[model samples]
Target: MADFFRLNKVLIFGVGLIGGSFAAALKAAGAVDEVVGFGRSLPGLEEALRLGLIDRIGESVAAEAPDADLVLLATPVGGMAVLMQALAPHLGPQTIVTDGGSTKHDVVANAYAAFGERVGQFVPAHPIAGAENSGPAAARADLYRDRKVVVTPLPENSSVAVARVCDAWRACGAVLHTLTPADHDRVFAAVSHLPHLLSFALVHDLAVRDDRDMFFTFAASGFRDFTRIAASHPEMWRDICLANRAALLDELDRYTAQLATLREALASGDGAALEAAFDSARTARRAWAEGKLV
Candidate 1:
């Protein structure tokens, strides 16, 4: 069992789905004494408070960041740099800052540039859990339970800060995993990011076709499962695709080549090649299902 401590107060910025879920989890687990949500919108703050996601709502980042033991940035990836710049002047020396942003390399760099040696207080993290939904209303307290939470610590990051961040996630029922920012971004590009792009592209391609509605009406569970990620926030996915462009593009190219090879095999009536390929994929998928990937 992992040791857990009750944080004095945690300032969570942008209490949308991930943020709201995190707050709810902390509250449910009795891990935090206070959760102060900072958002520009009054309705969002009110909703979060009503949902019991936060103890109180702070009006501004400066006021909220200074008093927090932990500060979690849960906004979209593109907004991280701007948010970090805004919160930089107000962060307390003892505060451990972390994020639920999908991309790490850019976010880690931005944190370093904004805070310099104070970057040691920052631990960049991405929870490998979320839904195809947004806002407090869609959040659930148990959303992160048994989920993998990846913490990417830079060279400047303090071990104490990293451990604190890990403990916080553990308290929320998440299993902690450590990875370098570069490796995290690269691996996620193939396993997580690429699938999201493919889903969006597939749905877009189908929607644009002449018989889209007719085709969709006949679609089955497999289609729904394959395109579930397409329902994710467009702006967020757009930012992720652009942020992890290099790794995503490489994975996309590899996937396209594999698809082309399958098509060629079918056209050439190569039964043995098709069978071998299918068997290989089945074996790989079965291994994944059996928990061999971790």
Candidate 2:
């Protein structure tokens, strides 16, 4: 029941939120004919296959690589280097690979190490879309619709490979933008990684308190909104934080500096200084929200 059938066969590595969503989106759009999935859990892969997110369960990367027109490494960043090494040995000439790792520089480095001269076949991308929940059950075909996807293509990547990666994301209704991997990591550290870190830290702080139950009982919308991302996958975020630790640490330092400034303003009873800072942040946030597409 495919329409265009742009990809004869696609291989998915994780079969979780990002991977499941991609497969579902592509299937819904008739963009691909068959999807073969590889993952650590047999039950999870079975669920993905049962949900029609993928057609078959893939065994060996070497066995599957020759037939995969495209491969998506949707696993955590920590696992990427091994996956890259596995695929590098048997990839078809036309098989182009891309990943959903949040930290791009490390992923790009992993590709360089694994692919070497064939590194051009791997295009790096980060989809600016996620939900508190994960796994195949949490995936939906519309997850990436109108979402921003950053593609950090290597200099060695050919135009054709880059175009195909862009087109794949487009098929999921994502808006594509390009950046150097370093810039992508730095920007995401401030906007994405830092926020997740803060959210997780805040939740952890509350959970470890003596009056934790009381805090939970009285928590309201503001707390809920701020800590929503605390519900994200732990191992994935751990890898992201560690992989992009340098940039994340710098952003964290800057954030702590702002916190210190606010604390000083409060201690000095400088309502005006606090108000000025709050107003500036409010205005910038409003402007960003107004122009935001996702």
Candidate 3:
């Protein structure tokens, strides 16, 4: 199917890491004939063009959206509503739209509002991969290789549309998975969102401290590893946290409760409790790294 399905011309709404990577991977695999990019700024698009990530910078949706095989909304979730409304009128009958938004429910809602009867054209997706750096220069053709891409298809989507989207991801060497938008938001809130939130919070807490420089100077591998995601694009993560607030708040409260337990253990000098909790986390982390727990 990967060999059978090919994109003649693809439109990318954001020429940053995710979208640039998609274009690069497709070009690398000889799967896409042409790639057009549209973004918040021309300089970014020009950078993507310079990097060979796109064939051209899109000037008008009306002119390019009609014949493009796919349109990828790779911007922050907060920008999707405006882009959806802009693209809906010019969107072609066969042009299937998909996204790399971390939160799916909000994306689906925006699609429903913009496309109405044509919501089937928009297939919601989230690629479970990224790096610390961003922009066109940071994009690599192998970024999505062996990574999981979760597609939360609306009931309005036809089998053919979903299959074609799946094939495109496979061409980028991604593994496909499916989930409902609600489930997708809920699951990622617990796993991905919570971790990023904690990472950001930990770094911020340290940064505001009077001895921040001292802490940073003494910080080592463990601190660097834990706070790596804190350096992620602030605007992007801000949109994700707000978009998935309900689920994220619930997970945050649960984490808070766990933190309380740890605080109590530390205050009471409960060595056994600390050891047990650390041991459990160590076991789980090792199991996950070994691919023994899925």
Candidate 4:
């Protein structure tokens, strides 16, 4: 076991959902001595403080970054570049910088360019957990428990820095997983991004149809469950979609082809083909749910 080091004066940029929840989790776990939140918005910082998500508020990234033992970037993916540039000069040699950005390749690449070898201290991570709701008001300290957190370390990353980040996630009750940045993007493009896109498209299609109200009235558990991701933040999803455009497009094309096959099977009343496909999917899903497959 690695010797546990309690973090001191952690600085969190962006006190919204993920950031706020992380601050609350670290505080509850007694892993950090003090949590300082910095954001462009004053209301969010006030709310985070009021909710006990953070101990103090930093007036600016430059003022806070140098003092933090751990600096976390929890802003939207689209804002990472700007934040990276702003904090570059202020980051101390010993500070470990990490981000909760959904996409890692671009964020990590930009960090390397901006901070050079100091980027070795930056660990890119994505906690695969969230609710439909966002902001400090919706933040919950227990949100990270049992969640899978993927950390992508570049060849230049310091082993000590990586271990420290893995320890932080472990302290927060997360199951840690390591992967290359490319692999992370490819896997999530299929499992996370594609499903969200399909859900939003399905809901939009229903809303524009003549029988929209009727369809919604009859919608039950399955429909509700399937479309739940459609309620996620539109701007965030839009950024994700654009960030992983190539992988997402490939997955979209494959999904469309499968949908076409199902459509043709239904139109032609091909019972045998339909039954075989459905049975295969059901067995696969059942195995997945039972943890029988990797």
- Which lDDT value does model 3 have at 153? 93
lDDT of 1: 0.88
For model 2, how does the per-residue alpha-carbon lDDT over 34-153 read when each residue is reduced to its tens digit? 999999999999999999999999988888898788999999899999999989989999999999988998999899999999999999999998886789999899999999999998
Which ten residues in a row are the worst by lDDT in model 4? 1-10
Deviation (Å) of 57 in candidate 3: 1.8
lDDT of 3: 0.93
TM-score of 2: 0.93
* Candidate 4 lDDT tens digits, 1-294: 145658888988888889888888888888999999988889889999999999999877777788688888999888988888888888877788899988887787789887786778788999998886788998888889999999999787888889888888887888999999988988999999999999999999999999798999999999999999998889989999998887788889999999999999999999998999999989988999998973
Tell me each candidate's TM-score.
Answer: 0.93, 0.93, 0.93, 0.93
Better of 1 and 2 by lDDT: 2
User: What are the RMSD figures for all models against the true structure?
Assistant: 2.0, 2.6, 1.7, 1.8
Instruction: State the lDDT at 161 in candidate 3.
Output: 92
By summed lDDT, the worst window of 10 consecutive residues in model 3 runs over 1-10
Mind giving the per-residue lDDT tens digits that candidate 1 earns over 19-105? 999999988988899999987678998999998998898877777788788999998878888888888888888888999999888
lDDT of each: 0.88, 0.92, 0.93, 0.88
TM-score pick, better of 1 and 3: 3
Model 4 quality (TM-score): 0.93
